[model samples]
Target: MSTWLPASPCTPPGCATHDGPARHPLPAAALLLAGCALALTGALCTPIALLLGRDHRERLTRAWAYGVVRAFGVRVRVVGRPDAHRGGPGVLVVANHVSWLDIPLIAAVCPGRILAKSDIRHWPLLGPLAALGGTLFVERERLRALPATVYAIASALRSGARVVVFPEDSTWCGRGPGGRFRPAAFQAAIDAGAAVQPVRVRYFGAAARRRAAAGAAAFVGDDPLAASLWRVVRAAGLTAEIHVMEPIPASTVHGRRALAGLAQSTVASDRANLPAESVHH
Candidate 1:
């Protein structure tokens, strides 16, 4: 089954320009410290959450995630609310890949284990956090790991965990063509009998997001960890809009290509409303 709705208009705020070299702020460092503290707090509370049911554990996990993002001084603005019904047991959330920040942003909203590129496992502080958050790593080129990854995703879903996957596979500027949504993520949803919830991640009014994208592209041939995280946190505060599109059932969307289109269309329609921004002098 398919559904269509009118697109909402959106425009990112003007980018605040800075003179000379970008300097780090004490608050940013403090936020990092606070996140570490939250992680420790979560660790301490795990046993209690475990005593609760699976639902409680996931809720606590999400609360911990919210703390981390909040501690980072990131502002989350959810545009379209997630459907509570679709959010129930065994749903696969497929979101458009915008930035590395997408991970935590999704975690904030859906609060689930996600499949990330294997390279994320080697990242600095983020690597450890991702592991602790139960992220499943996948090798893009290795077909052998496909089965294991799929099985893991299925297990996560069956356990009432929402599994988030970025169909775009990589980040791109929201201005124009991002990239094609890889079919494997969608295929995994179909194979697992999970419903797909499309989310659009837009980092509005942040010069840092643009700079981060450029730095990431420049470091594509080298170590991205250092450049990536710095660029992400360089801004004063990042305002991200997570618009949840209507959910699509895998049982209804059988073909991988068709599912990919459905996911892209969901994102594209919402993105059409976002206000375009250009860096100023």
Candidate 2:
């Protein structure tokens, strides 16, 4: 019943898994473009999504996202499950930020209303898609807006809406310990009496896990979106991994800072356990 399998060459850092289908640049590009086209064409589902109940809407969104992930030729493996949390207010999922793909990767496993940066609302095709997918956009850069954003997330939690938050506030190379988890979002869970779920996301080569995360996987620095997309598709045998840690009950947790520290430590510790990954204090 466990999604965990025998250790994959990719699962352990530095292990090379040189066994799989031959990958080429052109084919990867074509597949990626086709996948994007497919997602765009599927826009009709949005209006339908609006009419569906909460559970149904979440399922619909997950299926759509998984489809896109496969189109990009990215294999995703999710460990742990979300159903573990007792029925209550929705959960607040906090994860490390890696690349744009993190969104779909998370959605495919446990689709929810993702709390994203506000500007994403204006993105070209993605903007419309996000709207249909029910993204909660926040202007994170403005200190004054933090309260409003927190309040919105809390309200959503109270309404039983699962919200995915990347508390890093920025993307990292994902090679070392990721950025620190910002505690602001933790307040939402406390305010709404929702559980906090800490998740760790990692990327490895599909066949040769020994190689570093595909250039596409890390969105740090000033990399352009177009280039990152191409890098991901072109990099053959890319696989993504997500580990869902145990949920910490808000009622049991003392303060927002303590909650944030616990979740961050949990995530950091999980990453360190990846045999191939090492983290510094």
Give the clashing pairs for model 2: 13-276, 17-207, 206-237
Residues 74-169, candidate 1: write the lDDT tens digits.
Answer: 667787666664344578898766555676667767876788878889988667666765788987767777778877787777666778887766
lDDT (C-alpha) at residue 31 in model 1: 65
State the lDDT at 24 in candidate 2.
85
Report the Cα RMSD per candidate. Answer: 7.9, 7.7
Clash number for every model? 4, 3
Candidate 2 lDDT, tens digit per residue, 152-254?
A: 9999899888899998777765655666677888999999999988888888774445335533466655566676676677767778888888888887879
RMSD of 1: 7.9
After superposition, which runs of candidate 1 have C-alpha atoms over 4 Å from their true positions?
Answer: 1-24, 36-51, 85-89, 118-134, 206-223, 275-281
Candidate with top lDDT is 2
Local accuracy by lDDT, each model? 0.63, 0.74
Q: Best-fitting candidate, measured by TM-score? A: 2
